[model samples]
Target: MSKNRYSVGLIIVIVGIILLLGKLGVFGFVWGLFWPVFVLAPGLLLHFLYFNRVLPSAVLIPGGILVTCSILFFLCTIFGWSLMAYIWPGFIFAIAVGLYEFYTFDKYSPRGTLMAAVVLAILSGILFGVTILFTVGIYLIALVLIGVGAYIIFGKRRSW
Candidate 1:
């Protein structure tokens, strides 16, 4: 067989296999769950370019924000959209991450930028804590009570 014909035959086989897999829903399942990778890719590329000196540090701002938001989106996609209620604070943190990255990578970085990042991070943490507690506090309280009762019944007493 001619090399051109042989290569064409291989290409036809690969295409057939790909189509078969597509019909089986493999591609559908992957694309449905991992679509955030599309958002994450540019963020990662920007960071890579900055570190390699191919781009200015300003690019890190969007890079950091995209990376953070993509992670939040990926978490929601994998765990369920309902989890977004508890992690909504992550949006604020994403901007903070972007600002912080800029402050870190830029030689003329301003202290106010760092301050803003810190404040946003702290606010995000507080909001996340509040949301988690409100969402699941009852379960935690129940577990604590159960543990205390169990310890009283079965654990050894310590010196008072």
Candidate 2:
């Protein structure tokens, strides 16, 4: 009887605390910032499962994609959505990461998947560079070129 009474008392206290926290809006604040952890947790769990040999290595494909994309999402959320324009190629890079993980962990260790991963990685790199060049990077590149040209025109020529 005392045990039952104690349990009921603990439950009432816990419910009171939860109600107080909810009324204070802590849930909203925490959810807004940490929602992506929902996405990241399953990916990490899949990785943990595979590493523990409880699941097949194939799970790594989705695991890698989820983990990578979650990190990217977290970065965008923390910084600003505008950064997505500069970093959109990261989606392609996420696929490459998934394929690379699958290639790495699979028993067959297929070469084709590795090649695909490499190609996707290189493509993502090229796209990322091009996107940068089209955005703020153009101004930076122009500034560098102008500085070099000004030095060449105004400074004495050195014998090489």
Per-prediction TM-score, please?
0.84, 0.84
Per-residue alpha-carbon lDDT of candidate 1 for residues 56-132, written as tens digits (9 for 90 to 100): 99899899999999999899999999989899999999999999999998989876999999999999999999998
| Candidate 2 TM-score versus the reference | 0.84
List ranges where model 1 is wrong by over 4 Å. 144-160
- In candidate 1, clashing pairs total 0
Candidate 1's displacement at residue 159, Å, is 15
lDDT tens digits, residues 75-127, model 2? 98899889999899999999999999999889697769999999999999999
The runs of at least 3 residues in candidate 2 whose Cα sits more than 4 Å from the true structure, single-residue gaps closed, are 1-10, 149-154, 157-160
Residue 62 in candidate 1 has what lDDT? 93
Q: Evaluate model 1: give its lDDT.
A: 0.95
